[model samples]
Target: MLGAGLLAAAGLPATRAAAATPASTSVLISGSLASYSTFESKWNYLYPWGDSHNGSALMVASSSNHNHVSLSGGVLTLTSTPYVGDGFNYHSGTVYAKQQVLVDSSWPSWEVSGDFQAPSAKGTWPAFWLTGVNSWPPESDILEFKGSATNWSNTYKNTSGAWSNTLTPISDPGAWHTYRAVLKKSGSSNVQIQYFIDGVLKGTHTGAGFVGQPMWLIIDYQMEGSSGSPGPTTTTYFRARNLYLARSSS
Candidate 1:
């Protein structure tokens, strides 16, 4: 996931401010839903060549030859393998929901929930996050595991040119855990975000100037960032299952 600081470093536009107001009463949309079993038809592999990163790993589109990403047994696997190409020494996986699977004005209130086994390798960075389809600084990172040192998940929200983050410690990152994020437009251009882990609320953040904008989901296993240089020399993997998305009915 791109942190607020990293977003700024990438020359993305700053977040805009919106007036604070009462929260919106949003409910899950009855039929706007998806899961791993239906993922392929609803998602697309993100070609990873023009993105910012300090890692040596390059993301590749899903293909028979590469097999960087795969879906089977109701689970999705994103693997990072050692490869020598484009002067880089590794290859990993990244995928995003199809453009049609966007949270826009028609469905501003939304939720993404899933079970994941976070990779614990020293130099791995895995995240389940959301970003604006047509803008920046409106990102919401539901779960981000930086490495073994940070054996926990961090949730981040960028709004009003600022970032709000909360760290929830986990004893074993390799163990499967439930992660979820619920977002609702609370005002004309503001959203209220709530993060949950294993059904327990971990954090809440409100983002300004982000309401009613189209946002897309991203799940990736990046090799390195602030985690350090020289990522795992061997293969590493991130796995997720029971992934789901839904929109508000009201």
Candidate 2:
């Protein structure tokens, strides 16, 4: 049940980084937030690595392969099926935006929000997050389900590895919920990042040296690592919809 707050505007062209896709541009996002949902399409399958991201599941890259990635109605599902024998034991899905957001001083105050219905079953990890394109740190974990009833909001400050985490427990883990992040620059160097669940503010954190970093937005289903071991033997699912990124002048 998406609301009026699900921001959507015209889709635009964007460049890709190292992926096999086309290319991307660092456009100053202004006005109402627009949707640049493409490396070429709405989603790009897998990380540039094609599979596995510090997790037990192997990412399935083929868009035609519904066993790992499927789209029905408006929801995109990333599945993790164990014993698939696809070289990595468990097969899953990962997708990234073709668009990149520059986290510099000039970037307009932007917001990224999406509706996700993820598995809370142990060993099934799903994340809606952003990471640096050429480096690490300056990461904003919009919504992370570490195989629990708790939603973890995290922001990595810098390369030296300082981060702040806020855990919000879900009363109904299977129900659809909205998660969002709003970022505003604090001074000449850092940005104040705020976390939200169901339109309510959860916590606010500061990112160090975030002004110069550019990041790629990603959503993937990982198994076992932070979610613990001995995962579900049956197939697991992670679904997302009504995703948008908006910018404002302030």
Candidate 3:
């Protein structure tokens, strides 16, 4: 297992000196939909990244729309248009922190929490995940969905093995829900990733450590079949608010 501090140290990108320092960050990006698409010749957007295979795209909104996303008052939000494709099979929205926030090496434990809501469609897939800009797989899948109460799963990635488990209370895609996770460095390289739903305990993963790296948080709303279809099928949507990130004072 790796120490959380070492994990944080390992994840820093070479561009670190120019990114935001640990304390806090605040920025706003707003514009019309037509002015954001690369196809429309507007490319000044700060940090918009999406995958066609993932069947989703993201944009900045001066006011708000189907895919309006941003960070305000210490929380992140993702709002999208109504998705009609393949039922609930596909739709997603995502955003990355443009100015990286360094993990406070002084804290032995850290936590990231946020609220999310999926569109009313039956097949929408959504996630609030963390990943290392330096690697993949060992990336954290902190929160994920499958749309089936019997099949919902949350996963945590670690060096030893990929650990996963089932979850229910089944997030209502049409309404808001809160989620939180705590990663505690308890040993040389072992840490625990704890999951919470609406601030209540849901699940926990212990002894998995992939922390010795600089990582970024990702909130996404994915429409099913968007990644596998030969063409666009239907529309999908997601709405979110009240995101929280804090490090244990200990």
Candidate 4:
């Protein structure tokens, strides 16, 4: 016969089980632009300022004469060459993705990634980042060399006050390395951003009031400013391959 205590405990109603959440499915949105025409199809040449952004004091992006942006051997190159144009000393390249990223119920997360071989010499500023298309304050820097041996991962949100940046050192800045960022919804109005280098996790931060907002993925090759004075006189390059965007599907 079973003990009375055991029988009494068995007789009690079992604890109610909690419902499980549905796992998200990752779907590819964009992949590598293998050719120049393909690159043009996926991205816009420059900002609304027309070949210039961020005050345009040092480098002005240009799409003319295959001077700044070009694709060769499956690798996209953004070159910075010394050019006396429009009161700017150097001409470089910048491109913005045609599709914007929106974190909503349909797509609660996103991923942007690329393999980069960027410059580390003085006055060289190359970055892969995302910013608001219609507003500011919601920005994420997946890879920013900042003219040093360190990569800077940053997230900006004015709603929460101030910004956040994490620096990761690289032994060789010109070597090829994978840079990735995953943006997932943390709550109804906030998002958690994670930065990865060479597929390894580097930094994770929260973006305040970033949910339901649309952001444009941008890659720019600039000169001077944060790097150092007297920009590089010789031609410099910012090379990237397999730049892509993915989303979480149902």
Candidate 5:
């Protein structure tokens, strides 16, 4: 099933599952298995005041002329362009799935996976992450590239005050690579998270306090925080596609 209760706020009705449930399995929520050809149909642009971290960029909404986001050939392109507006010299894009909030106990297990081509320019920080709906610390950086040759992926469980991360080496940020995370119940009120890149298992961690609480997704191409000052002088772009999400029976 599509988890109508979760998507109702976004105006998307829950749809019937496309296949039969396994004898030992149930799918709680499933995103479109096909490509997302339009931005508004599945996601909403996020506008954070003052741009988080006071970066040298403004996050803009999707529009016809600005060209901050586009979808073609099953690929969604998110661009960061130089623009002088409101004393800021650059503007970029950030978006979140319409079904934003997810709680660990809502389902037994869940998976989030996608193909990404990171932006390579200096001071360009692009990330696909999850954050607590009501607080910070309970966040997961499924994929984060801080304009470096290495990529960082991590999970944070605030109640336990623990974090787990993996640093993977990469030669080309512009090349498409697969990234995924699986979160499943480990013990009472706790969960184990596994991170993967290009089909290889990268890291694992166990944490509590994430269960039974809400977390929302975030994807953005930011500038000059820990990525350093003076972002790309020219326009830079990041691409992602084949984003898939599903919940499994406990």
Candidate 6:
């Protein structure tokens, strides 16, 4: 487990889960605009915004002409071209399953697991994250960008003032891979958060500040370039599939 580092740019609901509690659930936010749960834009800032802010993340949808997100065979595929904004440029897309549609009905008490095809290149940052209905950064980020190269790895932020860590995967992220985060309800004795890579336990957290509250799932493409990372020289894209969200039986 890696310690929470200095900074980097930043950046669910109930129901579906209640009606159908699959031992595992696949979360794919794509295709027709109606397929997505509505998301209200929160923070639009760049990053490291003054002393660890809250209830805000940087995510935007594609313009009509640029929009290219879809759900095929239960997989959420996201793609887009470069766009100028916030003193920087980005060419990625994002969709949220928020509002009436949610992953869980409470807070500090949710787990998201799935396989993701990590983005290849320095500029690409893809993630599976969640946020509070009222606060921003406070939401947990289960998985994040796994850079392309030696020693490249993924990271997580338990924004609830819980715990955060960086993880190194055994396999290359260029190909499809599985990742999971189990957020157990905080108890008077033991509160824990577990992370797994490709079905292997990688890390765990305690005092995660995770309680019972509803949260929604969100997936998106992120770029680190202030100007869109040279604009994807060769058709780069992001894919997240076979996702599952289950409330702990305990």
Ordered list by TM-score, greatest first: 4, 2, 5, 1, 6, 3
Estimate TM-scores for all models: 0.77, 0.80, 0.60, 0.84, 0.80, 0.61
- Name the better of 4 and 5 by TM-score: 4
RMSD of each: 14.2, 12.6, 11.7, 7.5, 9.5, 14.9
Show where candidate 6 strays beyond 4 Å. Answer: 1-66, 84-88, 99-109, 149-163, 188-191, 225-231
**Best prediction by lDDT:** 4
- Give each model's whole-structure lDDT: 0.69, 0.75, 0.50, 0.80, 0.72, 0.49
* Cα lDDT of model 1 by residue, 44-162, tens digit: 67532243245666877454433778776666788888887687667888887664234445666778888888886667888888776676656788878776624333323455467
Q: Which residue pairs collide, candidate 4?
A: none
What stretches of model 2 exceed 4 Å from their correct place? Answer: 1-40, 84-87, 158-161
- Best candidate, TM-score: 4
lDDT by residue (tens digit), candidate 6, 105-194? 333245566678767566666677665554443355566663453222222234355446655644567677787777665554234666
Span of 10 residues, lowest total lDDT, candidate 5: 27-36
Candidate 4 ranges beyond 4 A from true positions: 1-29, 55-64
Report clash pairs, candidate 1: 29-247
What is the per-residue lDDT of model 5 for residues 137-228, given as tens digits with 9 covering 90 to 100?
A: 57788888876878888778634587677888877868999988888876667777788988899988765677765677767777767677
Cα lDDT tens digits, model 3, 1-250, are 5555665687754444234545433222222122234212221221243333244333334324324444444334454454444533323346554423223345556677656664434344566676665655444555566443322335555444765774655545456677677776767665667777777777776635554655666666554442233323454455555545556534
Model 3, runs deviating above 4 Å: 1-92, 98-105, 120-122, 149-153, 158-160, 225-235
CA error at residue 78 for candidate 6, angstroms:
1.0
Give residue 22's error in model 1 in angstroms.
21
Q: Looking at candidate 5, what is the lDDT of residue 149?
A: 71
What C-alpha lDDT does candidate 2 achieve relative to the native structure? 0.75
Least accurate stretch of 10 residues (summed lDDT) in model 4? Answer: 12-21
